[model samples]
Target: MKLICYLSLGSPSLEQSKINAQNYIDAGCDVVEVDFPAKDPYLDSPYIQSRMAEALASCDDYSEYMKTIEAIKAKNPNANFIVLTYENTIREIGISDFIDFCKRNHLKDIICVGNTHPEVRKELISNDLLISTYVQYHLIPEEVEVAQNTNGFIYLQAKSGGKYHDEYKDLKSIIRHLREDVKISNPIYCGVGISTPDDVAMVKAAGADGAFVGSTVLKLQEKPTELKEKIVALKART
Candidate 1:
């Protein structure tokens, strides 16, 4: 079973991502999902920006992003880095630019969460982007069909919006439908609200090809070494 750890480096510096990467590597995680807000409504609002770096940090700028990526790579050279972008920002930048960036980095995968075909396909869907969709919970067979049409991986979010849980009861039904009904042959990975070592076991047993754990790992800031150890333990399960 492969465990993909989501690293939300919600910080002013690249410190969180760097630490998360090192821990993820040590923990035996198969990949490290590097996420940045594609667009945050509160970024423009001073009230929230005062509290959250993801709300206040200037991570969207290309230079800052590149620097952060370099720091993360330094920490774990072999760790798979899948960049997670929100649909809005990706469409805004033009899909071509996004594809070009991923190709340049040799990323095995790149995902546009909450994105639609009409918003992206015209630009470079046929290119080698290796995209993934975030239908999350409440998926339709067509959503799986659309993702299949792109010939990319499927990102099954465990909840509505972005939330985590100990066990998502809906996941099994959704995965079963997507597999048996939609005939989705590509890889199936789950994200959202996965926060603990035990949660990892639940998803893996639910027939998920992998699980993306974010908040728990990111919050393990002061004790990255310990956090990575836990992750590695989960990776060894089953």
Candidate 2:
């Protein structure tokens, strides 16, 4: 199994997001997720917005997202980046062109939320499926069909909605069931409500092929090398 860390680019200041990504890379996270900023209005989280404002103040333009990837890859050539974000920007920017650009530049993947646009299918390479997570709820089943047809993996959310608090004691069985219900071998990764190395253990036991960590990782200190070590230790526990 592999791991993908969500790196806040659109949603977070470039500096902070890069710092967070470097931390996870150091901790042994298998992959990274680069999400767009202030995406969900319902968050109604003033505090979140406040934090986001600070992050975005220093954020780079969307075009720099790819440049940053190349820079990071130059340093950590083995690491892969997932261009995690909402789908609208893609449409605005021209999906086909972006997909071609990503492949040409060597980006690992793109994870989209709140959409399954018919046109989205043309974004990835000939056989790349648009990755979906459980955050969308009630949409996974239909989305899975898209996954099957589009060649994208079905990413499962392991925990309940909202951030993963320390209160979430154990959820291995639940993760297992989600994977089984999906009933496919096409790379299922669980995310949301995960905090700590133990959570990684639970998801692995649950039969997930990989795990996704975002806010939890951002809460961690910067330092990609060390972060990767921590991730490896946690991942091995399962």
Candidate 3:
């Protein structure tokens, strides 16, 4: 299973973000999700929003974030990297310009948590960048359509909105509906409050491609060894 670790760039500090990302990669994370700190990330829960706020307050500039990406790539040449951000960030930089920057930096995947218009999706596809969007717990017809047309994968978020247990059924149901009902074959990644190795196993067993661990890792920032162990365990479970 693909283990994607979500981290906010420049959170607490850029140096710390770099260190955390390196630790995640070393811990067996297949992908490190770099979040562009937005002023308002509505799709995120309180913990993630707080992290983004802290990151934005410390460094609002995207230049340092871009450099962080380059630095991470330099040290971990084979590590897969994806940017998770709101649409406002893309609009601010202009879509084509953003795609050019991603191409130059070798960042191929983009998970637009917000601001997913058909035109924007089309443009990103034209640039050949892998595009992903969230699939909410309460599946909507529109989201099913979006899933069918995604360039990369589908991010499945639970309804409860935070890291918790008992979401396996919900996740399984959604993936089944999308795959069996909607007949969309995109890779479905379960996120939003998934933390433990058991959680990862449950999702993967339920037909998900992987689990996106975000807030849990951030919470373990001070405990690097424990965090690494957690990531390693999650990877092992798959």
- lDDT winner: 3
- Candidate closer to the true structure by lDDT (higher is better), 1 or 2: 1
Supply the global lDDT for candidate 2.
0.59
TM-score of 3: 0.89
Estimate candidate 1's alpha-carbon lDDT, on a 0 to 1 scale: 0.65
Pairs of residues at least 3 apart in sequence or in different chains that clash in candidate 1 = 27-232, 163-193, 164-193
What CA root-mean-square deviation does each model show from the true structure? 4.8, 5.2, 3.2
Give the per-residue lDDT of model 3 (tens digit) for 1-238: 7888888788899999999999999899988999888787886778778888898888888778878888998898889888886778877767877787799888888887565656666787788888987767776568768778778888887344543334334666767778877887877788876888888888788788878888888788779999998888989877
Clashing pairs in 3: 163-193
**Full-model lDDT for every candidate:** 0.65, 0.59, 0.81
* Candidate 2 lDDT by residue in tens digits, 152-187: 556666775643424322355444444465455567
Local lDDT at 121 for model 2: 43
Ordered from best to worst TM-score, the candidate numbers read 3, 1, 2
| Range of the 10 consecutive residues with the lowest summed lDDT in candidate 2 | 132-141
lDDT of 1 by residue, 20-53 (tens): 5676777677887775554553322342233245
All candidates' TM-scores? Answer: 0.77, 0.73, 0.89
